[model samples]
Target: MPRFMGFVRMEEGQGNPPQALFDAMDEYIGKEAAAGHFLDGGGLYGTEDAVNFVVKKGEVTRVDGPYAESKEVVGGWAIMQYDSLEEAIAGQQDFAELHRKYWPEVSMVATLRQIPDEPPTPAED
Candidate 1:
């Protein structure tokens, strides 16, 4: 099976949804995970808590955010495995629809990208 990442983006200023919406999302996520479509996922704190770094010629620089000007930022992500790209896309589409239905007041988007499959290497004994 090929793996895919479902990247979740949210518009700035859109805080967390209600408890009911979180409950519903939790239910949906549990079902999908039990069925093996959802391998891993998580939501992130706002950009104010984020940090940016740059490294050049062995020198490192760090920048802390109040990264306020960006209109959208990644808020969450999901990893899934499926037989084909279409299947991966459809699975992500379902998740996106869940947000649309449960968090109608918030703006969220999910994009799917295929992860290259790699065979596991044997352990040295």
Candidate 2:
């Protein structure tokens, strides 16, 4: 199975989706999980609340908000586990359709990748 990241973008000034919709999506996702299609997933707050960072000349610079962007910014995301890229894309397409109905301007960007087996450890012993 492969891992995928579903980055969700919301229009400016658009608040969070309705609880009922979310609950329905949760139930659907739960079914997928039972079928071994889900690994882990969650929502997130607006990008304005996110801390941005950059590196230059080996120095790190911290910004108060999300990094500057020309297009819609990522508002939230989910990590999905699927049998193949096609399956992951199909799932994302379903999510996008649902999102469009509830969040018309929202978009889902899907990135498929392999989940690493271990987290990176600190250098210090």
C-alpha lDDT (0 to 100) for residue 84 of candidate 1 = 80
Position 20, candidate 1: lDDT: 74
lDDT of 1 by residue, 8-74 (tens): 8888778777787788779988988887888998888888878989799999999787677888999
**Pairs of colliding residues, candidate 1:** none
Q: Write candidate 2's Cα lDDT for 63-90 as tens digits.
A: 7755356255666667788878788888
Task: Tell me the lDDT of candidate 2.
Answer: 0.69
